[model samples]
Target: MLMGEFWGLGVRFRVSAMENCWDFLQWLGPDASTCVFASLDDPSDLVRASAVSRSWRRFVIANGFSRSLCRRICPEVSNFTRAVEVSSSAMNQEVGSSTAVEWESLVREHRIYSYLCRCLVSPEGSSDCIDRCIGASSTDNFPDESIENTLEPSDRVYMRPSYWSSGGEADPQVPESLIYRLGSDLCVVNEIKIQPFKAFFQHGDPIYSVKFVRFRMGNSKLPLRSENYVTDENEGQAAADDNFVWTYISPEFPMLQESVLQSFKLPRPVLCIGGVVKIELLGRVQKQAMDGLYYICVSHVQVLGRPLSPKLALDTSEASGASVLKYFPVDSSSVAPNGASRDDEAREPSRWHAFAATLRHLRAGGAWNQAILNTLLRPVQFAEEDDDSDEEEPYA
Candidate 1:
């Protein structure tokens, strides 16, 4: 995907220049070009097609095809107000020499969105995004067995309790939720894995597993100030739900009373903006022998997804959960810097830009729906049709 940065600036396309590559913009005009390019189904194809020719690349940028493609794959991307890519001063001087600076901004958008589309749909690998435990609904032994322990991947380690324990509750229906902060501002989540803890030290090795569990992903309304950070040391100081704006809520999943880690793959990959995850543990199925009260315990939890970082960042300055995508493209001599690239610096947008944006909007309505229909007609790797009915319950 790093090569995408160069493709956005037409770097890779320079050597492959040809006189006649269908030259759609010249032969058929903008409307026909819209229907043809917007019809491209794959994000990778959309990016590579830009390298066909200079007109083709300009048409892709001016139309915001990359953005349209992304929004089609992941609807949450539509929430972004706009995308910005910062360029260096040397690039600014280059843009200063050009009369049409708006075109440069569009090129930046082309690169940024191509990268985003790749991250959202065709992620390469998995990583847990949990930065730290924000808080837990309850804790039986505070620091000894707290939500922080869930961050540890192992169920047992170095004579320490490597799990989180909930305070005993009289009613099994009482739900408990754990809050966590993902290190990045945005993460594309595919699945969440949870491991129930087996108290090997205790007699009979009881496993404290919840009967059902659910998940919520969102962002906090305000920046997490250090003074208000929640931790195992802060007893009963969990972050409240009122502080977040949840964008995705998963269906409740039944849990097994076993020590093995269980995976709950989402129906579809979700774009987690603002990077906050709330794991809701519902329906306690285990009881502490001494107190004879219901308790929920978890050994490990993982939100498996790709977190775009280093260059890509979110602008949290706006309301929480509504983060705008920001891309920092490594500026070449051709890139444009802020003041020089600002659209206001240019005269009224050329008809090509205006018509292209309009065409993208129209094509998005129909062509995207057609693409979705075609996608549904075939098998998708992300979606599976399996039910838990065939699995046997673990012996408690």
Candidate 2:
């Protein structure tokens, strides 16, 4: 059966089968070959397959199998409305060739998605993913028992009470929340751990905990600085729910009334694109003796996940809350979208040499991390520069 034709911006691809052919792609045609490649669940398999031959590499990338596989593993990637090449126009002008620029962009996408796939499959690291505390919905005291106190793992720092308390509310159904910026702009959250406060100084040493807890993850509409804050704004106005565009909201789980570290794992790993997590404490469990109001108090909080950064970063400058995934590959000169270089003749070869090195390692059954990924993607460094350093580079 003949598969329908593929319509690309500048290139048209036709899919038709042949009666007899020794080559795999020739006999199966583009459509069948694409399905076979898409069946591969492992990112490493796709990388090794790309090394089989030039035709195979072109088919794999042109079809965008890596990106599809990534989305299959985590559905949340769909929120990235679209991808923007960091510097496309500069590279396009430097290439000065539409044909080469179109193909080169495909290769760049392959490299990016390949690296991202490997990163996503990695196990959650031991370090906590919380980078800084944004704010709390309510704070009973001005600064002493502020939201900042929850950053410390321990309930007390020296002689201070290290816990955040919500302003006592007469209604027990009132909900409180804590907002925090994760360590990276992108993360895969598997679970969250929270510790309730134990009022040791007070008589009877009562524990203040919430009856239920829920989590929200997304990007802030306003830009957030890295500095940890303890805003003195009124309880409800500071960390208002309207300030963020949440992408994931976990089901409400019952919070233990004990003063121990409690863990609540999600149904599945959630992809936090904007890297902001809000913890909502619902139904206060403890009532203050001095007053008839109830409140929730938390001593420490932690979000456990894998941070995809130091190689990749999220650009949230857009007003729509959607992000642009930016690439920061090590070999900037060689990995340009259109194979940029001062020496026009060497431009195309430089990109291929980087891929060849990667193939060599893959052939040896080597497992690559981000460091190895960048190393293999880097072309050999030239000690000397071309005489026309200011001139543009293009694939000839």
Top-lDDT structure, candidate number? 1
lDDT of 1 at 324: 71
TM-score of every candidate relative to the true structure: 0.70, 0.71
Question: What shift in Å separates residue 229 of candidate 2 from its native position after superposition?
Answer: 3.0
Q: Point to the candidate with the largest TM-score.
A: 2
* TM-score between candidate 1 and the true structure: 0.70
lDDT string, candidate 2, 352-379, tens digits? 4224433433433445465665565444
Residue pairs clashing in model 1 are none
lDDT, residue 119, candidate 1: 74
